[model samples]
Target: MRDDNASPDEPGTSTDRSGLSRRSFLTAAAALGLLPAGGRAFAEDKLLTFEKPRAFSFDLLADQARRMAMQPYIETKSRDPKVLDQIDFDAHWKIKYRPEATLEVADGSAPVRLFHLGRYFQLPVGIHVVDGDKSRELRYDPVVFEMPEDSPARKLPKDIGYAGLRVMAPDQKTDWLAFLGAAYFRSAGELNQYGLSARALAIDVAMPTPEEFPRFTDYYLERSTTPGHELVITCLIDSPRMTGVFRMDVGKHGPVVMDIDSRFFARDKIDRVGLAPLTSMFWFSETDRPDRIDWRPEVHDSDGLALWTGSNERIWRPLNNPPMVRTSSFADRGPKGFGLLQRDRSFANYQDDGVFYEKRPTVWIEPKGDWGAGEVQLVEIPTDDEIHDNIVVYWVSEKPVGRGDEIPLSYRLTWSKDEPHPAEVSTVTATRIGRGGIPGQPRPKGVMKFAIDFDGGYVAKLDRDAKGVEAVVNASRGELSNIECYSVKIGTAWRMTFDIKADDPEPVDLRAYLKSGDQTLTETWLYQFLPEPDSAA
Candidate 1:
């Protein structure tokens, strides 16, 4: 989830492109109009000397993926493992792409730059430019990149392909869209700061078995005729158990918008297939920090998972770095929308001016059509540091996908600072946990206290001593006591305080919402209470 180069201190291998040139070149050229005929034949002959443009279409790519899925999955091997190993983190940083070689598409709205192959990203992906019906593969060349003369990249062969690519702004300095490393891609969002990532497909994530990472083998980029329209990108995804064809219409006006249409074919039985899967980092937040390790108040790319269920209920579930991997599923018939959002936008909350965690983008997913019966699942993995992306959220259909089954999915991904459709009712602002007992009395042993804050909506209109306003609180398995709700002095936000008493050591699931008479005044707040570790043991 940390950009494509976020591998923990190890090296890997790249994918091979041995069977790329097997298709008929002359037939494809004739159909695509790449070669000139009659009078113009001699004029364009020099342009086609190196690589010939071939006829390409989305249907052709889908057919290729279908044919590949029928055959056994073959893992692409690295062409030069030793050379890639030498290009470690330090060496990789020094290898920069030349500015003059940027692929200027869409009337120069955003230029495309290739990412150099390195230790973290060893697999080489094919890059092509589609003009009209004809497409030409951008052959790998060393001259396009600048590196130190003593750099190990010089020792690699001339045919060493690129690892990934990024779309830079019109200025060609800052990158807004990037696609790199195992079907992973991210945008800077409206705030123009990269935070979380969205993967093409997720297989057996957070499961007992080792996770399978599918890689994008090839990419064909086409520019739009309209000046400000979206860029069209077609990609081929391959893995040991599946193959897919994805088409992304990507554009960045205020926020980055990606309209994705993909067809997936499973080669093996998958326990879970996460669609529109998002990956982020959440080390600690103000809600519950058992260990006050970091100096910053919070460290997270995304703070909570916001959901708009099929039943029209809006829910907010604060993310947690639990003691063990936890998977929470919310069943729905057809989900309206869901996303991992960084709601807290204040800079003072994070206090870190370097990375600007507060400016991180909120990624929202809006399903295009009826997804049928499915559940929005969130997987939280334990992490002590911010380097590892331990949080993942996605939609899993109730119906399972088996071998040879082709599933078509479509959705729109909005990378922005706020959720696409925010709840009309008051939302949970903050969640604080502490000792259970009163301040004057000795703290209760097997109890925990919670203080939740709600602001805006109808709750903000009420006075300090408003009548009929109530806090609806519940726990899965615990005694809830000492519940109080009142408006804070400094702001119009209402604070709800409560304590949960439990004798068991198992974690407790808690939910709370604000209500006035018979009307729900706020979105539901959910939290998982982890039992305090015994010091006497």
Candidate 2:
């Protein structure tokens, strides 16, 4: 929820250790200069320009990036520091850009609004409006916004430069597209709720070396000539390790989709680089509930990681609140798709109206080319609340991305409530953990019971009484007992029940999936069960 002082971009008020300060992470720079009455730059009606003159392709930008990588990295610095810092959370809300000042970057319903610089975002990015071979820079002006007389933003100077930019509808009522923070961007998905974020690239993430955050230093926002709503964006990315360029074609439908293409250049010897990285929050779910007390049942932006392999296998791994840092990888030749999904969409699960967790969007990434021989890596960090985005997934190529190499990567990002491709196979719906055995019947020595619900597909038409379903359960270091499977009456789903008795205090690796005769009914369910605590002798 946003307070009077917080910026509109704030998703929620969860504290985090993401190293981004409130001003830097939550708000873009928000102060501009006073323009002359004649509009010093040009009239509102001017065509935007690009290096290739409205040519919507990645070849030109990739060539620029490859040339940039041969040079050294240059950091950004603006004239004033105190003025930027003063635009903190509270002060940022006071520096809103006016709706009448939108730039028609495309023929779509959405118009472009530039963000000013504040205390946190001192680096100002240049915003250009492009059409055909014509392009012109959109000049910043302070008089456009309506701020209160006593507001703290009055102390800031004009011409400080804009921190970022956002895209609003033609009516200037709501923002549909936004590019605020470092290499991170998101559109209001089909549900109109912003959930996950997509990054230009990820370098040396989870590596021993300090993670390098590349910035999209400049952006060219172009409007389309055709009446149909279409816009083109060309961006330049820079970091200490590399520099790159990107061109994106954005469309608005039920869910905003971006056809993005980019090329990377390495400044130094590079070993690790993640293409099309996504960042999301995973606090707790049915499988990994928090120990500390809270009013709401669960808190998270996303619930599980869904992957579609090149072999056409669909895999779902429920996110967890691990005691220690964990990273998992699944190797593939050409992955069909992958995404971090917010599956538990029922409002009753959260029961909180303030922050609508049910409306958060799910992001799916579809590779444009054959990203041969790579593993989809998932990195999980321990998070106690919904603030910190502890879950990250990206495609890490098996072949190294080293110095003097230009890597061309392209993909389409889908922001929606469900995965891009629906599956005929059923999926694990719910997971529950409790003490083993009957209530008063001796409590079964060293066992703990687990109930897993699998829904979708032929699970509903299964033999209710004639042919009983089977539970193919296995544990790495435990004795499985009392395994059972039955049809769930509430919906067309099947329930698998089982118990495991560990011989020692060690982690138990468990895997199970339904199989009838020679055919498998669902994706394999994998779980890492930790040792249970002892109570009485």
Candidate 3:
């Protein structure tokens, strides 16, 4: 590791660091009594105001959460909701955190910044700076933020606290990591584009009962002493049903990786609890591109859910823009890993350039220890527009959670262009559904055609003339026919075509794979097809 005490003029010290290494700089500052022990850091830095130092640690935070669960839960409220209501999306974006106020923490590294509260995000979240075991809370003041004279944010009180915080790139331009909304946080992964968000915890999600959103009410940030890890974040979450703590060690590699240690305590029994939940938008892709809804060829942050099972099997389940709410669960003993991936990288596929959907990062979750028996649950809610987040995936324990339950889990989140695991078998590249019968022929009623593409594994090297390539197919409610698989010829990709004859109102579970003799050549492609009315079957 580089010397933390190195001077700005030091040969190896980068200019962007501004001579301040977050860990050492803050440590040295606190030693000098930068501000009165309890008052604020504002005297030293106008952007920050701090409270007195308090002893803190990961275990302490978890213990506090457990204690909080034993007591009654209280909901967080805004100091002035009426004023915040005037600051809508347009007004919020107009308020910017001044560059001079950037918080320090990177390899000596990235600068950290604060976010302002607004209409959509009104609940104040306490932000703190941690130096060793002592942490100081940063008080909110309008001096750190800039806005126009007429901006409604100016009417907000000084102690409104921050809505969230983000870590900026060395260039002081783009933010690589951000914590915002409820328990939501996201990383601008390999491509440096923001997309999906991961939650600290999900309670009773996608159930008949209203989903509970646990708020990350407080944050403790410290510059990591570890070589690659840049920032350490501790979040205290509170909800009506539970209280929890999430400790994250965040770092940037080829992918942005967050090693998270989560502890949740329940005050009452939860019908369902989702761990490591990922949220994103999946309006429409090639599989079911509804006309008039969007002019873009495809629109979605992620198109498929990829899973690595404990049995050493791989499965690729394409996402769908269902007509109704859909929840699918894949059971497992100990899941190896899973993620929502945007495999289609071509810019032409997305068309519109404002927010590059093609560049949206893929987030994979790898359990650090045995997760035991659980299932990867995917809940896709119907959406007619791209504005709403409609896709959610998380791990749900087979064991039930009840009152006074304290659950601990650890996992690593990799935000990247692709999953961290090496691909040894061909993966589903594309999935398209359309009218069943052969093109130019009379379309068969109650029959839908399914075409899937696979590339980049054993199938790529297989002989084009190999007749042994069998398109093994199965469906829960329909007969599959016209099955065929062949090399596409342009790339290593191969295509599988088939038809499913299903008229049932329920979704049809279809599974398909390719193999030559005893060896499986591709990951299992599972599709939950929601049937449509058809005159012919």
Candidate 1 residue-wise lDDT at 55: 84
- Model-by-model lDDT, in order? 0.77, 0.69, 0.77
Models 1 onward score TM values of 0.90, 0.88, 0.90
Window of ten residues with lowest summed lDDT in model 1: 23-32
Model 2, 71-170: lDDT tens per residue?
7776786677765666666666666665445555453355666666655556777676554555556555566665667665566676555667766555
| Candidate 2 wrong stretches, greater than 4 Å | 1-24, 27-42, 45-57, 150-157, 224-229, 444-446, 466-468, 502-508, 530-537
On TM-score, the stronger of 1 and 2 is: 1
RMSD of each: 7.3, 4.4, 8.7
Model 1 TM-score is 0.90
lDDT of 1 by residue, 71-164 (tens): 9998898889988888875687667666656665555776677778876668899887777777778777877777889999999998888787
Per-residue lDDT value at 424 in model 1:
86
Q: What's the distance in Å from true for residue 58, model 2?
A: 4.0
lDDT of 3: 0.77
User: Which of 1 and 2 is the better model by lDDT?
Assistant: 1
| Model 2 accuracy (lDDT, Cα) | 0.69
* Candidate 3 Cα errors over 4 Å, as ranges: 1-43, 106-108, 439-441, 535-537
